[model samples]
Target: MLTALKEETYKFCHEKIALLGLLVLLVTTLYSTLTKTINKSTLIFAFGAIEWIPVIIIAVGAAFFEMEYDNKTIVMLLYKNSSKLKIYLAKFLVVFCYSIALALGAILLTFLLSLLTVPGQYHWLAYYQGHTILTNLLLNLFGAVIYCFFIVGLSFMLIMLVKANTVVICIGLVLAYFGASFSTALMHTFPTAVGILKWNPLNMIFISQQLTRGSFALKSNLTNFQLIIATVVYGIIFGLLGYYLFKRRRV
Candidate 1:
C-alpha cells in the first residue's frame, strides 16, 4: 500500500492541471497581500483565499478517473490485475495527500511573498495559530484540505450520478453563484434564509474567513452539531458510493 500510494501520489502531483491551480493560488496570495489593513484575521484571510484553490483544482483531479470513461484507455486499465477497491483507494489517497501538500506548499510560498506585502501582520498567526507562521499555515492547510477532499468527494458523487465532470462543475458553479446571491439577500433580513445558505461548501471559504475574522461563521440554520454530523455522514456516503461505483463499473 505504501509503494502503491507513493506511485499514485506521483501521478497526481505530475498533472499539469494541478500545477496551474497552484500557480493561481500563488498569484491570488500575492494579490491579496496588497490591502492596507493589517489585522490578525486580515492576514489570515489574505492568504486564506488561496484555500479555495483546491476547491477548484480538486474537481479537476476527481475528473481524472470519471472523465476517463470517455477515453476508452482508462477502461483498459481496469481490465488489468488491480482491484477496483485498490484503484479507488489509491486515487482517493493520492488526491487527499496532493491537496495537503499543494496547499502547504502554496501557503509557504505565500508566506514568503507575504513578508514583502503584509510585513509583520501575522501576529495572530502566532497567537491563535500556535505561535509560528509555519505552524498556523500547516493547521489551516490541513483543515482546508479536508474541506477540499469533501469537495472532491462531492464532485465524484455528481459525476457518478451524471456521467460528466463538465456537468458537475457547471451545476456546482451555478449553485455556488446563486447561493451567494441568496445569502446576500438573507444577510440583513431576519427571514428563514437569513441564518442559512452560507455554510454551503461552495461558499465555505468566504464563510470560513468571516469566522476567522470574528465575524459570524456561517450561521447554521441547522445548528452546529447537526451540521457536523451531516457533513460527516455526507462524506462517508459519497466515499462509499464512489468506491461502489468504481467496483461495479463494467470496464
Candidate 2:
C-alpha cells in the first residue's frame, strides 16, 4: 500500500497539469493578497478566486489523470504486483490530496497576503474583519479543511465514474458554476428541482458565506436536515461505486 501510494504521488507530482494547477492557485492567492478590500467588486473576485481553484483541480484530476488508464498504462501496474484495491486507493488518494492542497494553499495565501498588503484594511467585513491576525487565519484554516474534503471528494467520485475526462471536465465546470442557479430558477416551475438543489455542492459555498457573515446558515435552521441526510447517503453510495468501478475495470 505504501509503495503504491508513493508511486501515485510521484506520478502526480511530475505531471505538468498538476504543476499548472498549483501555479494558478498560487498566482490567484498572491493577487488576492495584494488587493485586500471589501466591496461588491471584490466579492466577485473573491468568489471567482475561491471557486476556480477547486474547479480547476477537480477538472484536471477528473479528466486528465485517467488518460493513463485509457492508454493501457494502468494495466501495467498489475504486472508490477499492485493489487486492484491498492491501485484504486493510490489513484484516489493522489487526486484527493491534490484537491485539498490546492484549495488550502489558495485560502492560506490569500489570508496571509491580505495581512501583509493591507493591515487592518479588511475591517469592513464580518467577524474575521475585526479579529486579530492569528484569529482570522485560524478561522479560515479550520473552515477550509471541512469544506474542501466534501467538494473535492464529491468531484473526484464523478471523475472516477466518467470514462471520458474532457467531456466530464467541461460538463463538471458548467455544472460547477451554473448548476445551483439554474436549479433555483426552476424550483418554482419544477418542484423537483428544489429537491435536487438540496444536494447541490454549490449550496455548501452559500452556506459558508452565511456562516462567516454571522447570518443564519441555510443548513442551520434544520430546514435542511433531509438534504444533509440525503447528501451523506449519496456520498457513501458513490464512493463505494467508485471503488467498485476501479477494482473491476478490465484492461
Measured by lDDT, the strongest candidate is 1
Reference-based lDDT, residue 166, model 2 = 73
Backbone clash total for model 2 is: 0
Question: Against the hidden reference, what TM-scores do the models get?
Answer: 0.72, 0.71
RMSD of each: 4.4, 4.5
Residue 231's C-alpha lDDT in candidate 1? 50
Best model per TM-score: 1
User: On residues 94-138, what C-alpha lDDT tens digit does candidate 2 reach at each position?
Assistant: 776776676566555655555565556655344444554344444
Model 1 C-alpha lDDT per residue in residues 10-57, reported as the tens digit of each score: 766676656766676766666666644545544454365544555564
Clash totals for all models, in order? 0, 0
Which lDDT values do the candidates have, in the order given?
A: 0.57, 0.57
